[model samples]
Target: MNTTTTEAVPLWRRAAAELLGAGLLVTVVVGSGIAASRLSPGDVGLQLLENSIATALGLTVLILIFQPVSGAHLNPVVTLADRALGARHGGGEIAVYAGAQIVGGIGGALLANLMFAVPAALSVTDRAAPGQVLGEVVATAGLILTIFALARTGRAALVAPAVGAYIGAAYWFTSSTSFANPAVTIGRIFTDTFAGIAPTSALWFLAAQVVGAVVGVGLVFLLFPNRKAQP
Candidate 1:
């Protein structure tokens, strides 16, 4: 005879959060890269350091702000992983979340370009080397594992800081600078900058990320066999 008082967030609101969060995340990534490139034109190492710090801080903030609304996926692979593990229900949700992320990411790239006074331009960076591909696989796998492992272990609250720290570390460790999110990778193609990837290179990177996601899912099952995937 008891009635439930908690109501789910409306789909529109959830979608809006995803869009805003993803957009701002990309804006931070691309804008920071641009600023870093200009600020440290001669020192590649300094540029990377600047870019990684900004991205880490930005991601932590975005995840913390939007997590309650839509789980703060901000990445298609994360959404797909949620569905695969039954943490989230419905293919419709996946479609909506992924679509919003991609749209938001593209808008973010354009916005960054405009802010930097650079004309909208496609990336010319050809990051298709074998070493770069290997780096991408490793980077994405590590990222997914970091997120899901915390989520499965009843440490979901730590995901924001953990994920941010992981990405910042991966940037220095991976030759490809850890472009782990598919939507973010696609967005980077719209701008020729320190962080951008050529359109052709992005296709290969996406394929590697998908493979990495599968590896990460398998590892999650292996490591946390008894827990439900709850990201």
Candidate 2:
């Protein structure tokens, strides 16, 4: 489904695209969250709605912008899943992409804080709970399932919108508000805003995401076993 071959574009260039894409994705998420909080004030539901809409739209655009270069894997889990599902990336490549994504995500959060005139600080909001952890597992697993199902079925063209829609819906369906991305989750730790998560909470989220990825990959293999189904 990823038409961009490694030979067609240098790995370094692809990594750069990944960094930029991940950065912008976080920017959209954190920035919109800040705006939503300020605009909605006491109305938590309205704030969430605004944030979710902005994130969904922003993600769709970013994917379309960078998919041809790096498959627009703004999330580390997605990148790792891509590799596990046979995307032709070597171990070094995966490391580079994941590292770039994490760094870029942090940068994005910092930028959002600066833009909102808020000092960059560690989040105090703790979300470490059994229900939230289970929610993360569900959110991440569904995310992986959505992407791979489309990719494996040769419907890669629909991935951007489909992923955006899935995440938007998951925001309401999941208790953790669908922080399914490790990079984004880590980035959020830097901003003490409405969307930020504390360090301890992020650890739980990252672990759950890893578990969810494994489950999603296993499901993918089960549902689409034939190598010929993979583009």
Q: What are the TM-scores, per candidate, against the unseen true structure?
A: 0.94, 0.96
How big is the positional error of residue 173 in model 2, measured in Å on the Cα after superposition? Answer: 0.2
The C-alpha stretches of model 2 lying farther than 4 A from their native spots are 1-7, 227-231
What tens-digit string does per-residue lDDT give for candidate 1 at 1-231? 000111298877878888888888899999999999998999999999999999999999999888888888889988887666556447787788899999899888889999998787899999999898989889988988898787777778888999999999999999889998898999899989888999999999999899888888888888877664343
Expressed as tens digits, the lDDT of each residue in 134-225 for candidate 2 is 99999999999898887887778898999999999999999999989999999999999988999999999999999999998899899976
lDDT of each: 0.85, 0.88
Q: Which residue pairs in candidate 1 collide?
A: none
